[model samples]
Target: MFAKLPLIDYQPLKIIDIAQVYCTLTHPHFSNQIITDIDQEINIIANKSQITCQQSIPKHEEELKIIAVVKQLLTNLPKYSYPKLSLKFKRIISLPGKSDQAIAYFQTDLLTDSISTDLIGGKLNLTYNLNSCPLYFSLQSALIRQQDHRLLPALAFEGEFAYGNKDPREILQIINNWSEDWLTFKEIINQGFLG
Candidate 1:
């Protein structure tokens, strides 16, 4: 009879590690393929968290919650100049050969002073162009389609956080606070989808 062995615990794979490996072993359509693979992995991990509520149409209440989060960020930085408010809806071709007509999918745009906070395709993007970085901050939920055509959500973050002479501690604090708020917003969105 063989002795039983203990199970081995493993740490989660980092996105950077996965990217490095993929980049090393390049293949055809590597960019798209890597993204798809990563998305699939994220979806798998997300499903484990019990994302049950999937709806065919995204609700208005959800949008309101997201907007509230952005507004809260602006409110925190009262010293900064008030940015102009603009609401822009982007329409995309829902189906093939429908170039003439397109359905408005995501709500995008919230120009707060120099900061451009956008909600596109269920992702929050904070862009600060005054500094060297173009794409400053981003948070995205790993969106997967349910059998009923609904979507389940998972969270992911991207973008650079670098120290520069142009960005003072106060400005950096605002960005940091915004990121924290974004995380809170993600939880709300997750619950909305799950609940």
Candidate 2:
């Protein structure tokens, strides 16, 4: 014969523990590996879509969207100034090439090579000098919003909030309100840019 035992529950939970509980219970183990796998899959899908769109020849469906975002950012250029700002970019037409032909607005500063890697978007590695040039920061906002590309302008950039400065989100909000479209701008270039 066996005796019946009582089931008692004893646990400690904090005020901010509810969300954690929900996330853990709902998502389960799903370790970092799983998360990385899922993220990679989604990225692959998005890259495919972007490639398809890019390769669609002169079909300018999203042209206005890009142009509007760029112009909107350009409109607010006179507001702020960043002395260390430098600009460089390359188009990933089936793995960006290894050359300096695409360099824009500057002669000496060149994009010698580029690669597709897990670190950055098509890894646009470049070699240039850091002279005391008056490179504006607003362009980053424009570029970020223009391509709507994920990842910050710089590898070390952490969103728009850093070193107790103005919140990036707030600046973006101001831009969004002023732009013709409300909340349509999804990306903000130069996320880590600062004076």
Candidate 3:
């Protein structure tokens, strides 16, 4: 139902390959983390919409809650395996139809990896080889496990990996750096502790 809506500023993502029992080419943790975040937002939206009609209060509170939840989810995510990211994203394919401008492909692409880091979130900092716009991090998330069960601090979110930077030059650097370890890439970009 929320397929066409753009709740976040970025393009809407389809949380495919949730790894019920296994995974394919995609980075298991990163892909699942992305899915977790998206589903979290969906849950918030659904809950608010379900009860908003019953209550007279505006949905600003629910929106804030959703944001807070996302932040916490980010905080709880575990770090990525650095070099493993580039290898995992061996390929990618997107197919967005009219009105439904969304990506519907899996595992494949042909981009030279570069690297970059950002001080966007204080000192935590994220580093990546920009191949698929990586955004690595570390966390202990209480996310849903396989078999529809649950687990505490299950190393949710792949910790790093986004779709591409807004700039092509910087994006190039990010992708090119994917061959290096997280520590090397971190030092190259001068973010913080790379290990």
For residues 64-169, write the lDDT of model 1, one tens digit per residue: 2323333443466344432222111111111122221111112212123344334334455665453422434454435434479854332344443332323234
Clashing pairs in 1: 83-113
What's the candidate order when arranged by decreasing TM-score? 1, 3, 2
Per-model TM-score, in order, reads 0.21, 0.17, 0.20
List where candidate 3 sits over 4 angstroms from the true fold: 1-138, 148-153, 157-167, 181-195
Cα-lDDT of candidate 3: 0.26
Which portions of model 2 miss their true places by more than 4 Å? Answer: 1-67, 82-86, 93-195
Against the reference, the lDDT scores of all candidates come to 0.28, 0.20, 0.26
Worst 10 residues of 3 by lDDT: 48-57
Highest TM-score scorer: 1
Candidate 2 at 164: error in angstroms? 23
Of 1 and 2, the candidate ahead on TM-score is 1
